[model samples]
Target: KFAAELGRGDKVRFAGSTADLKISEVLSDAHAIADDDPDLETLPSSEHALPSEPATFDVMKRVDQKVVYEKVLDELASGGTLGIFPEGGSHDRTDLLPLKVGVALIAYSALEKDGLAVPIVPVGLNYMRGHRFRGRAIVEFGAPTYVNPDTLDSYKRGGADRRKACNDLLEEIEDAMRSVIVSVPDYEALQLVHTARRLFQKSPNVDARDKQDMSRRFAEAYKQLVARAGTDPPQKWLDLQERLLAYRRELSDLGIRDNQVPGLDRERRHAEAGNYDGDDVLGGGRLLYHIVHLVWVLCLAAIPALFLNIPVGILARVYSDRRRRKALAASKVKIHGRDVVLSE
Candidate 1:
């Protein structure tokens, strides 16, 4: 469910070699075992789930300091943009984790080498529902941070001086990354904010032109709400959240979605125009037409679903599971649909 944005460039250069890019190059974390004395079959696991489909591998040769610095130096020297995700690995979390220091070190070292004008761009991957199939995602790119030659000089000083310079640079990157992400205080807030955004878009003030714009607006709104609430959210906000969650829960129990509700403004317009009937309203000739249309569609869909999708899905799970002793665990946020199929 992760999304990322890169600045326009002449060519895209992957950070790793061709060998490390395969789907089964590395094993997942789900297969780790603990060795207890003479016994080596202990299979207790941790909470973290790595990515399932994509094989995880450490492109150690590319990441090595000498190699990485030389490679990046050469790229920049030839007017190339080197993209890197400083998080090292992906996991399911609302907030951004501590960035790898390698990015800062690279920029600093590059600046020192030949005063290369390197810019560290912080991009945020905002997923509406990460784990769900067809879930929406938005990529927000923050301002480009240019390397400070003086900062590199401090790094050259060695010891605490070097550490402080690097830390400061890392902090800057973190702040930039945070600016674009919808980082709520907790899971409850995350749900509340999402629910609110879906409902509140009915208001005239909120524009629905683009998902990315909506994300930015939501981030701004959440920031303001946090500011107003201080240590604790207002009781009114809490009450509203409770109501929204309750409504959502009731819909879930009935096997319906919020968008399926008849009262939705978009649904109302369609109903009034007589062009379509909301899924919530099951009466009228339109409903019968829809039912018939759906049946035929499903009948046609079954062919591909059975022969193509089912076999491929089964083969994928079986092959990945057999080749590795571990399950690849990855965390994803989901929104909108119930069509989620977890990656094994």
Candidate 2:
């Protein structure tokens, strides 16, 4: 979406998944090998495991690494935008994962060459529903940081101590990322904290309209909550947390959101059809105006509703369900940093 900002013909290189790189070769080799081996047919069960030390897998991994790293560095040298996740893989984790040193290495290498100053841009992607179709997402970009020239000088002197320089840059990158993304303690805490923020943290004067701002506020509130519940925690905080937890559960069970509850917002009440401002019934003229407005809206909406395709809608839903299932299955392999799966 931001491609327009770059110069014409400037290439953008994104981090390709290791699975995507190896899946084709692995599948082909595995299929051929399985077909050739008569023992595969005689296996006790279809779930029987393959050999752990497959030569093909190891060779492919090494080749992929070399090719990816060289391409990344080469792109940087040619003034192309090299965008890498640094997290290695896409897993659903609330917190940022340990970053790989490839980005730092690229920056250091680029700076070593004359007339090249690599700027590492920290971008954070916050998702409202990661696994759902057409889910809302916000992209936050932090100020660009660079590898310290002094750190590079030290790195040159300590030839074997590249780790220190990489560590320094990575630390800065992590700090910058934490500011843009919401990193809660865990899934349960995330739900409660988000609910608390939505219900109690918004202010009319403040610019908390965006989800990112609200998330930052939520994180701050969470920090304060934790601080208040230090070694000798207060009972009130404990009680409040319990209440929030219960509220989350109730919302889940009822298949509703916090914003849907009446009286939650004094200025308006939200319904499935639309929002009510409570001034609609103030006077006869106002009531007539509301009726006319509702009719106009219905008339405008009828055009699309009348032409809505049932088959197309069904196909869309089916496709979304399949995609969600596939994503869920792929994400299930990693239990530690699974993405938060929710519906919008």
Candidate 3:
């Protein structure tokens, strides 16, 4: 219905699951893989399952994860844009999960093997309400991040080189995402996890406010370290600091604290004037309330039955269509300007 409304014709692209058949046709040319395989012997059983022979299960799980990681890395190296939820497969209200190192590993391998730079773009899909039609959604596209080839070489030589390189790339990607996203406390903590991972790599002792803060500090430290170790420390460090500071400033503008990260206030009003608890069932309840509370909903819905309804509906449709077209037009008006930076 959405595609028909947008005049997209049958060009829909689906990349995720079997349930999405219509869109799946568009992904036929892309390399798509399931995020997890519970049937694999090497994969670990769910935590709810009773413990089995420790040695056997441990070995199998390690092998399974390794195989999956390696397969993904190979695909990316072969010039395929691989998509995996860095947060694994959680559908909770949380912004993100602790990023798996698999993406980082693939990126590092791609750069090392082909001298190719793969851009990891963090896409944040915010739905007004889950599993609903005519709800507003915002898909935020972040900047592409490249893995430093020099860092990969060091990781390749070390005992835990692959793991380290993967973690590093994950941290970089997380930081990039944070720069573009509107900060919510829960999501911020997830970001901190990446920061913590980076800092813990440098020194296990230093700590931040929470996991998210730790991740941010760690990313900052890594950026500083990278600059300091470069040929021109002052210039590189300044540039890096400016970018980081800009991100921090944006967070501040949104009233998000740096050290006092809090979870998302569920009671807060949504931009679309809808309630979203990140649950399909809860969303249904909200939908019911909206239907019951708004008299306009019933009046507008009854237009098709009235004698004059056709003209009224046509006028409403035309006005709504014009408003949308104007919005799109206004969004496309971009200003091109030049800036001159003078260094004292």
Candidate 4:
């Protein structure tokens, strides 16, 4: 449906050039061999699975390289958009994966065939508590990128120069993506970086986009500092890290988010509303009414939360864990696969 909308009236097909058919090899001769092989040993065999349905290849002929390649070029030539994840596959990593060359191939191919430089805009998909229900997201678009004409000329020359052109174009795409992406070294550092951002944030109502920009800047600087510091960071940074860590821990334990600290929230709200005086206070009756309202809301929230969480939570855990451990070797999601779970 989304693809149909994007393509207007045209039928939109899966973008892959080919699909491999493989079957599992459950009867390995030796348990030792299974254990010794990488990715938990039981990877699918190269043998093609039996085609249970008629005209399988005919049905799947859309995957032909030339056909798909021409289809992409047609889309570009028609002024229709093509969205490609240059990573080739999804993962839960805190950093960008090495980009596949396919993006460059498409770009270069289009430029060569049509003599037009298609503008590729980099988009960052930043998530807060991704893989959870009601999680927040911040999308940022970087500047439009054009394939270098010089590189296109090299590709036109053909041979080894073409390979280098694709690679060079891929590097340019990566740099463009990196400009908008909010990347961190690891999930643990991600938590700390966010906590530090919250700790130093001057305004309570800074929008998510600006917050994402701040996080990117902070994560980059922090990552650089850690690399330079090696095993031993400067004492000042260590102390700051410790303080932020403890503060975050306290916040978590109290079920209080950084923006929801008790006294600070009220003052901030009042300040935002332009009603704060040096020593003004909320009335006792109003406070009592708010406290009761909070309890009632909490009670209402707990009922639905408990009912919704149980079955879905367990299923999400099992599925995510299996995918992270058995299916995805490149996944960097934690033990629980919190970042990759689709159940959320």
Candidate 5:
């Protein structure tokens, strides 16, 4: 559908899973090997455990995920796109869960081995009132970020350092997603989790209604923050901080303890990860390109329609005339017998 809309028929090539194909010699030669081995350690332990119950079986399934991370890193290092859901699985209208560190490792390895930086683009997929049918969806591509080895080395040298870096990168991605797409505020989300935990602890017999109330409160807080922080602001840094604080308050009001807030952890990770500023979310550059493309498209359609004597050309002329008349009327300070005095 996208290809047809874009008039790019037969130009789009869809590839199946890269893992199924044998790696070419040239690509294999460029692949990097990572030292991380957590996947290997967890695999055997999972297999040995008895799956007597459903919960036990679920545990085994989680253990199996270790290999996926390792494989993704290897593929990325080999100059291939590793499609990963930072959140392990799909959820209904939830902001992204804390990003798994697997993509970070892949980026680090790729930079170290090939000196080639891979772009991690956040894709937002939204469904309308129903899951299917004609619905509007928008996909915005974020500016690319590279993982440097010198940067990674600094984090790897210290446990605390690495965790801090990881968190920062995750936050950057979250911010990027939020800029182009609708997402739950991080602080409010964390508060929701905290509220749920506290309620569970206090009343082991908590009902579904209590859980619903806690969720509703958190959502309300997020809405308030978004409203207070207009989408367009003069200073994004100050605006973001203010919005974050508002979101934090929302969480606080939901019985989430101050000590439980993840702000400190988020800051620490951002520093360690060497998080950098991204391009403006709504800048003149993209707008200019879109305008130019639209003009070109209009010209193309106009010429073809006029040459073919299609009714569209007539409609376009009428539409253009109406727009011009409206503009003229809007600029008029006074009008006397169709002779209008336009405001200078």
Candidate 6:
């Protein structure tokens, strides 16, 4: 439907579990070892039990996957575009899940089939609380990567070199995806990053998309810190989280938001520009500002929230919450599956 609207309907062919044939889904999430590289070695897989797929997925896995594989190859062979999730499943984690190796195999197979390089473009669908109403998302696109000619040549050698080629290509794909994603240790860390972003913001007008770069950096740094600290994080990090959470909670309790905090703009300028001449604390001016701010918020945010809740907001939330829980339960990798529900 979207393809037709986008005017690429003729050029795109979508694959699916049962409605269509996706080689990866048909293989029961198996790594595509059976594809032509006779030397491809089977690696240990699924350290944790994977989520249960729909009944159709189980039934589809029993069918020969070669036909679907051929269809994918034929699509590529004929210069058609192919879009795949690469993970072969939906996930809600802050970090990138382990990519299913099927995508790499498909690329390799397509290259070997016709001696043509297949381009893999990594796309990141980053969202801010995607399950919520009016949640925001950013579609970030990375540079297109192609299977290395050397890797293809090595794959043709049909030995351990073949396995190395496959592994190398898979690693490359993962790296490309990682380059465009904002990955943190967990949801708690993500929220902390958001709070920090809000406090450090130069202007209250900054939206989620505008802060994505800062958020990405914070996520990367925090993850690295967590990795270095091991089981227990540094006390300073914990203290910072505690303080930030407390500040945010206080803002929530008052009818004031982070943006509306008294002297927030003044402090932001002082901190960034190193100007300390002006007083950070406002007395009566602050009270007057907040009084006006509170009324404005009620007229804008609160009223709409109440109106939306009455019709679709609460009901959609209830259904989405239940679906999120179910998705989280069945999946090995998904942390919350909130994004999955929104996408669904």
Error of 6 at 304 (Å): 15
List, residue by residue over 8-99, the lDDT tens digit for candidate 1.
Answer: 11111122211112122222333322112111111112212233565434422222367767888888877898889887655455655446
The 10-residue segment with the lowest total lDDT in model 6: 9-18
Residue 80 displacement (Å), model 4: 0.5
lDDT at 241, model 2: 87
- Cα deviation of 252 in candidate 5 (Å)? 36
Candidate 2: the clashing residue pairs are 92-338, 92-339
Ranking by lDDT: 4, 6, 2, 1, 3, 5
**Residue 236 lDDT, candidate 2, scale 0-100:** 85
Error of 6 at 116 (Å): 2.2
**Per-residue CA lDDT of candidate 2, range 123-225, in tens?**
8888757666577777888888877888778666654467677777888888787877888756676776677777775553444236566867787688787
Q: What is the lDDT of residue 185 in candidate 5?
A: 44
Candidate scoring better on lDDT of 2 and 5: 2
Candidate 6, position 308, lDDT? 66
Candidate scoring better on TM-score of 4 and 5: 4
Candidate 3's residue-wise lDDT over 37-139, tens digit each?
2212222222123333321111001124667766766777777787767655434233333455567766766677677788888876543232232555456
Pairs with backbone N, CA or C atoms under 3 Å apart (clashes), candidate 4 = none
lDDT per model vs. reference = 0.60, 0.62, 0.49, 0.68, 0.48, 0.68
Query: Across residues 17-133, which tens digit of lDDT does each residue of candidate 6 receive?
Result: 111222321223332212232212232123222236522122222335588899999888888988889776776777665565578778888888887688899988887677775
- lDDT of model number 4: 0.68
Quote model 2's TM-score: 0.61
Query: Of the candidates numbered 2 and 4, which has the greater TM-score value?
Result: 4
Clashing pairs in 6: none
Best by TM-score: 4
Clashing pairs in 3: 14-23, 42-60, 192-211, 192-212, 195-214, 195-215, 196-214, 196-215
